[model samples]
Target: MHSRSERELGSGFPAVTTPLHALTLRAAANSIRAGELSSEAYTRALLERIAATDANVQAWAYLDPEGALAAAREADAERRAGAPVGPLAGIGIGVKDIVATLDQPTQLGSPIYTGARPAYDANCIERLRQAGGFVLGKTVTTEFAFIHPGKTRNPWRAGHTPGGSSSGSAAAVALGQVPAAIGTQTNGSLIRPAAYCGVVAFKPTLDALPFQGVNVFSPTLDTLGVLARSVADCALLASCLADPGGIPGDVEPIGRAPRLALLAAFPWVATSIEQEWAMHAALATLRDSGAVVTPVELAEAWHDAQRVHRMIMLYEGAQQMRDLQAREREQLSAKLNAALDEGREFGDGAYHAALARRDILIAAITEWLAPFDAIVAPPASASAPADLTHTGDPSCCTLWSLLGFPAVSIPIAVADNGLPLGLQLAATAGADERLLAVAQWCEERLAFKGLL
Candidate 1:
């Protein structure tokens, strides 16, 4: 028998028919502001879409349709009253379950806090509210945002994995359940999932967005990010969350073509042939579009990035989960416990040494990469795996996460299996705005038409 997704997506995975739910974040906000569409109408369409698709997708941890509609009505009322509406005035955003939401539960994808509700909104959520966006629901996350996979499945094809730990956020956006969603990355949580799901993921420099109300696994490496259908959408959502003044429209143009440094394959990782072909195709397209594409090799000092990143992540993660481990050992997964065990074996001296080495390499690589606008590589080793037992390997993302660089993943091609492929563009730390601009420029040249 044919599967459900094969039926829903169709044999060709045809261009998504233009429905109200298929509107982009920018288009939705503009329509609501222009009185051409009501927030309630837009929200109802999304709710119906979620209801129709989420049975197989399972992208949400918690959803309250009634509450979401109520908030949508409030936004419409404000616009009717002639009050100034924010840039994201009527947008519905899906928050990762780990982020605190006063109105919904932040379950952390663990049984230990099954029904736990936060008393206040996370800093990012509060900012999103100020920008006139409402939280549609909480998306599922892996246990403590660690290695364990969640219930989310790839939207392109059924029975395939969506890379974690930001599994649900990426899938929900790709499925048109929400225009944009909040996610975080310590290693590859944001980029890998976005790549696997055929969406845009932007992980800004470390601490670009605050982590105050988000559950912490590795305090040093944890960074808040956003997932959306397009590069401009990611820029909008991320800028809204990071800005203290709550500017929701911060997407800027790159006045000229960008210079990109291409690494055909990531170091010491097994990349699929499909992924390599996609990268080459993307580079050729960019070159034809008058952009500079130069091939570059990794510096010798950057050889141990994955190992060092693991050391720091596990050590800090172990400390962060210490109390929970002591109190509810049985409630945690064997995979998490195993990681924690490895982390505990890392003494303070070893952890500090890793940190010291990271500092030196950061400076070395940053200078080496200073000449280029971005370092381009494949975001993940391959398309989403055939089954959902585990998320894909994250070795390609380790170096950028370790150095606290700003990165964006742009969907470029679809694999032979009909799964999407993406290329990662990373820039120096503190160059977030410039990185977004370059990504936008590259995105225009690539002209990726994503599956809805």
Candidate 2:
């Protein structure tokens, strides 16, 4: 096994000459647009990196080097011909396996959908392509984007979990296999993995990015998110996916230090020694940076937020996948089958009640958060767990997901075990732009170097 320092320098393998794959998404795009770098060269570099390192990391579910090269050539051709190019022109992005891609099979990390290809691109994929980005390949997801583990191993250490079900997306971005990747979060799928893998993850306000054609787990809580090396990269990708008007410019500037609320308590979850220490260090950093960090507690209405979120997820997930439950129960993993069985026990009244409770909590939380720029908390119970049999806890992410709030996970410190510790910042619904701006601000203050 390679040392952590070597792993930080791209992949666990020796660094390649040129190392074009190490460029940030924004930098790569700008260089390509300026004719300083060819799309083909950039894509080829990333493909080479993936080839050298993926045997152990196993970040990709599918990779099409030939297809990616062809797309890159076309992008270069269009730019040379002076044809209109989109904002993400020439960029290669990894798509989570659950998102439908007409060109690649989306197996949903399950045997039931083995080799299944969608007839059309998911709306997010369509937007990405329309912006001149090409699909590098699909990254692995947990079975049906649920609790099952995927083949991916954390880039930081081979044995530790790379939090899922956005397992491969976070790992790939962290290792520079792809500059940025898209992941989804019905619960902690996006945030936890990014935290574990030492990358930035942005879960935009609910439906901020279209979800059409993405395999549905729970329409109520499912949200499309982006994982990338930095907050700016995430913002650029999100802007393209959310609005084709191109990346937003001349935006409002945050004129003062952000008012941040520290989430002093996470219900039903115990903090690891590493996490507690990391939080202490982060809070001191923020205070030293002239930002106001105040201790805040969840309101009474949010005490049962996790339970409510699970009830809604299971109830809706079962309904969405009822056909599969009936026809392919035997093929499904035992963990998933159990979840389905439990979901079926909830009747219409119970499901509706959960939704109602969710609405009340959302209202209360939104009002409570109205005074702050964003609320800060640990992204997970700890750094990635030391086993592959399970993903890390989702307690830190459940309430925000349930309320459809916008959240971002930014690495604040590294744990003693060489894993990244991320601090999560969540804003009220429809506060995505503000949240991103705030996250970037905090990121600068933290000065997190990630694995690099």
Candidate 3:
């Protein structure tokens, strides 16, 4: 079992050579824009690093070294041609296997579709390409992006599991294998892994980014998210993925002291003792720093969020993969197969009722969020668990996903055992920009105080 300790807290892996790797992303882009560094140089460095470190990490499901270099060369040529470069020009991004790419295999992390490759790139991948981001390769994902564990181990502690189904993407980012990667969440895929790996993860409102061509787990709860080292980095990437006119500029830092709502009881769930303390420590830090941290009651309906999320997920999972089950029943994971079976037991009326309840919950939570700039809580029940047999609980993420709210996980403290702990912040629906702005403020404050 992984335990958090002061020494383990905030100890991230070394930086990678790829422009998409956080440390290199800005510097590489700055150099290339100034004609001081060629895209080839950056790409080469990244490819070499991946070759050196990825074998044991198993963060990648597919890697196309030649294709990556070719793309980088093209980017360099475009720069020499004096063409306008996109915001992410020459950046190398790792894609979650569930997010299809035309140039790389899309395995969806399932033995059932062991050799499956989609003909077209997923919508997010298409957008990234259009933005001048080169696909480094497809990162590993849990089977069908479900609970079945992937091979990724947390960079902070090798024997521990990197949270899934976005395991590879989070691990890749945490290890400096990639600057940023695209991940999807049905339950805790994005936030949990990001927390476990001690990196920044942002799950924007559901449908905030295009989802076409991506493998679906739960249509109602599924969300596209980004994993990065910093909130600013996430904001920058998010801007690129969003529609040109729709994307806002750098959020002007909020001038007034930020008002934050702390979910006192967190609905029906009870937090672990360690998690409770971590939150208390975080809240204490924020309060001492002048941020208004007020206690607020979440909507009563949020108590059923987990069940509602599961009902939607199981129903959608069964519907989406019914054909696959017919042809490859034996290939599905036992856990997923059981889920499908359970889903089949629910009548359409019951499923529809759950959907209705979800909508009501979203509305109530949205209303509850009116007064606070953001809501803060523990990212998970505890630090990454010792057992890799099961991915940590998604309960921490259930409320936010159900409400279609934008949520960000920030590494706040480490436990006594050398594992990292994360603090979660969620904003109202459609207030993604504002949420990010508040996060930036919190991040700056934390950094200034040496609390990160």
Candidate 4:
């Protein structure tokens, strides 16, 4: 594998350079736009880095070096012409394989459709490109963004699962293979993997980024998000892909300590000792910094979190992929087929009841969160588990995903085993702007450090 020192970045228009792979998406774009970095050179540097490291990491589903360079070179030409550039101009982002792209196959990480290629770009892809970015490639995802884990290995430690189903997106960003990548979460898919991979992941409120052209696992629960190195970098991407005109600007200028609730309250879910330590350490840091942190209760009202999330996921997922099963039953994973069978057996009345309870829970949670700016918790039950066949437990993420609320995973500490431990902060539904601000404040206080 090539060391970081061997890879270098060059200047834009003329000739400039840095360790392009290490920079955040927003920072790289600024460098490129200012003629201090060439988009093509930067893109090439990453592709080379990925080529050197991807054999072990396996973070990509579809990579087109030629296509990426062509777009980057075109961007350089546009910049040289003194043309106006978008905020993301010259930056490259990895689209989760589930998100369709015009040029790459949208492999859902299932053997049933190994080479499925959609003819059109997902709605967000078009918006992303229009805002001055190009698709670097498709990152790996768990089959159908469901329970099945993908082949992506945790970049920080080998033989450990990177949390899924947004496995590759988080691993790519953490490995410095790409500045940022998009991922989807039905439950903990985005946040858990990012926490495990030691990167920043932001799952904005439901429908913040349209789901059109992307495969649906559970329409109500699934939401697209970005995994990057830092909160501000995530903000840069969120400003473009999040609900148009809804994203907040400059989360840095917050005036006071954010009112946050420490939600260590899931009776149904238990945290490992390592997880508890990480949470306490993070809470101490935040408390020391003048933020008001208080323990909050959640299980009393939503005691059936995991069960309800699974029910909805199975119900919707089964219908969404019914055709795939009908045509390619033999090709599907045994675990997936079993889940599909369970989904097929879920009663329609139970599904409706789950939806009803979802609404009720959202209302209750909204009221409870009226005072605090955001709720804080551990990203998962523990850091990435040693097992690769099973993605780590996602119980911590189920509540927020169930409510369609915005959640961000910020790496705050390290585990005894040398893996990352993260803090999960969630905001009320549609309160994403404030949520970003709160996350920024917490990020600043925590000052997360990664392997890169």
Best by lDDT: 1
Model 4 segments more than 4 A misplaced: 1-18
Alpha-carbon RMSD to native, per candidate: 5.1, 4.5, 6.0, 2.5
TM-scores, in order shown?
0.95, 0.94, 0.91, 0.95
Which candidate comes out best when scored by TM-score?
4
Off by over 4 Å in 2: 1-18, 244-253
Candidate 2 TM-score, C-alpha based: 0.94
Give Cα-based local distance difference scores for all models. 0.88, 0.87, 0.79, 0.85
For model 2, residues 1-452, the per-residue Cα lDDT tens digits are 43221212334336434467778888788778877677887888888889878888899988989999999999999999998778787899999999999999999999878899989999999989888998999999999999999899999998999999999999999988999999999999999999999899999999888999898989999999899998899988988888543324222456678899999558668778888888889889888888888898876657899899999999998899898889988889899989988998999999999999999998888888888998999899888888999888988899899999999998888887788998899999998878888888888788777543
Q: Model 4: per-residue lDDT, tens digit, 241-274?
A: 8666877534655678888999874676788898
For 1-452, candidate 3 gives per-residue lDDT tens digits of: 22211111123433333333335355555656766556666677667667766776789888888998899999989978988887777888889998878777888888766767778988788888787788888898999888988777776777788889899998888777777889999888899888888888989988888888888878888899888878877877777787774545355687776899987446656777877787788778778888999888765646778888888889888988888887888988889899988877878998999999988887777777788899987778877887777778878888888778899998877777677778889998888888888877777766421112
User: Could you tell me how far off, in angstroms, the CA of residue 14 lies in candidate 3 after the best superposition?
Assistant: 22
In candidate 2, list every pair of residues with a backbone clash.
none
The clash count of every prediction, one per candidate, is 0, 0, 11, 6
Ranking 2 against 3 by lDDT, winner:
2
Error of 4 at 103 (Å): 1.0
